[model samples]
Target: MTSAASPHLTGGPETLVICGRVDADRAELTPRGELVHGCADILARALAGLPATVARVDLDMAGVHFMDTAGLQFLDVLADHGRRRSLTVTATNWNGQPRRILELAGLDTTDPLTGLAVTDPLAAAPPTAPASSAVALERAECLHVLQEEVEQLRQAIASRPVIDQARGILMATHGCTSDEAWHILRETSQLSNTKLRDVAAAVTASAEADGPPPSPELRTALHRAVARRRRGTGKAT
Candidate 1:
């Protein structure tokens, strides 16, 4: 999906691929550029037709390397257009400065990296109408992306409870700040050679069994956190 685009201002490589069109109204863009004043016009024009559809528009930002205020304003314009047109615009695969800027600006970056809008238009066709193989292939790809996203979300949610439980256990035992507790948990996980989540679950489980200790709170948090690790290795805890 990556290829050299036209020469940039510096006569260097700049690439942007917008694929996954469900219809004339919706599509996805994968951008790779030093988005600055030099390319702001091009970027704006590229973004202009993005919201032509009345429903969803997804954008994958994993390709964008850099973006400046001009580029930021261009995205703002795109978002405003989405609003005016009642379009559901979303972006994902964010990292680094782009992610920070989007967060600061309070933009939506939760669009799945797929396109499912490929069906509604074709739905009204006669029941006997043959489906386009190209559309079928695209839809299958979209479903695959959606499935991967669902699995990722499930893993994240599953991990959150144990992590939070471990954090709380640390806070209560160490009398430490949340950040400090997190650091302690992370450090302990590293030192004990246990996966962080497994260590956290162990901590919570141990706390549940023995209850919180009075004066030996720190020892308990650390000991219980690593004991399961030792026990798993056939070592006496």
Candidate 2:
């Protein structure tokens, strides 16, 4: 049954159509001065309502322009849920900012357009059908294995947005390259006795509430840092 208000509806037998945004605002700019975080909430709520008989989910993200860690978390959750139901979830309109964010989070759209199976490079192998006598056991085992892998993939994918957001924040505040920002985050997390994930989460949350921007000072510092790094590399060579 489908409701007009809801962007997602469970169709008969084997399909689901989810259309909406997962973000709070549409015009918010990224550290790089681009709009982001659009239409994530709509997507999240839709994915949260997976039906048991669904074999495929078509996600329309064309209207989404900006997405944050929360949006990424929703995707991971949906991917995991679809896996448990043996459903394939294909995302459409993932180019531009949405595509960049997904790629940074390790959820490549070109992979398989499915669930956790896409995340697991090794899960493509065909499963052997069990003997009729032990069919129940086989089903249980398959479910269990798929669940474990899904959970792991979900966790990994969830972490990506946090990390990327943190990197973005660092780039804006510290005027560092993406790589340098990541390194700072890693080093700071190590020195502060915090998990890298925790640090990333803090940065993202802080940014949402209000934080620094990619100011001119930061850009200057970043340029200097890049130049220094280049010079060092040249010297070594």
Candidate 3:
């Protein structure tokens, strides 16, 4: 295995290992978090060295302790590039903050983590129907409306790498896939009775801070604090 303390570099099997901190200070600042320039550099290098017949790229994040919006954007760019190349890109060891970030971005998936042999979690759930004919159409309509709302929220935050980064962080932290990460975010938001955007924003902010992600218990407390503060002063307004 390659050392995880060096600059990001490409190795065998179309894999790229990004070691060390992503230098959040050097990244461009946005409402989300810092954006690392090094990510772009790494992506450019990785693309330049693409081998013929390469089907996927694996990004090992076990050693990465910190990243910002730019780093998240870099991953997004890499994912897009891989899609364009008709190649799949898998990000591993995406637990903790990194996994959470990716989950927010909607890029973390279990297929890669499970070596592509497992079934999709979202696809496994069966659809539900209304209990009576009187409200069957109404239930269907409600479900449709909910789906539309979800789609709208996704579209509204679609291009924001901060959201994606939060998703990634959750994926890593929970050992979940991208879809599972998203479900967790959504579920958390519902349980806490908070908006998805607010939850995502909080996750991004926590990841951007110094040090590793707080423990799950700490994370829950922080989320509650943030929510309470938002309610009290509307400071985030």
User: Which candidate has the highest lDDT of all?
Assistant: 1
Of candidate 2, the 10-residue stretch with the lowest lDDT total is 25-34
lDDT of 1 by residue, 115-214 (tens): 2222344543445535566555654564455445445555767998888988898778655557756666776667666666776777687688565432
Clashes of each: 0, 13, 38
lDDT of 2 by residue, 191-221 (tens): 5566678767766766774754434533344
- 222 Cα displacement, candidate 1 (Å): 42
What does candidate 3's lDDT look like per residue over 47-164, in tens digits? 5455455555565556454343445556556656555675655556645554444444444443233322223455334354443553556545644554454456456657367568
Q: Which candidate has the top score in TM-score? A: 1
Full ranking by TM-score = 1, 2, 3
* Candidate 2 wrong stretches, greater than 4 Å: 7-44, 48-51, 111-115, 118-237
Q: Worst lDDT window (10 residues) for model 3?
A: 24-33
lDDT of each: 0.55, 0.52, 0.51
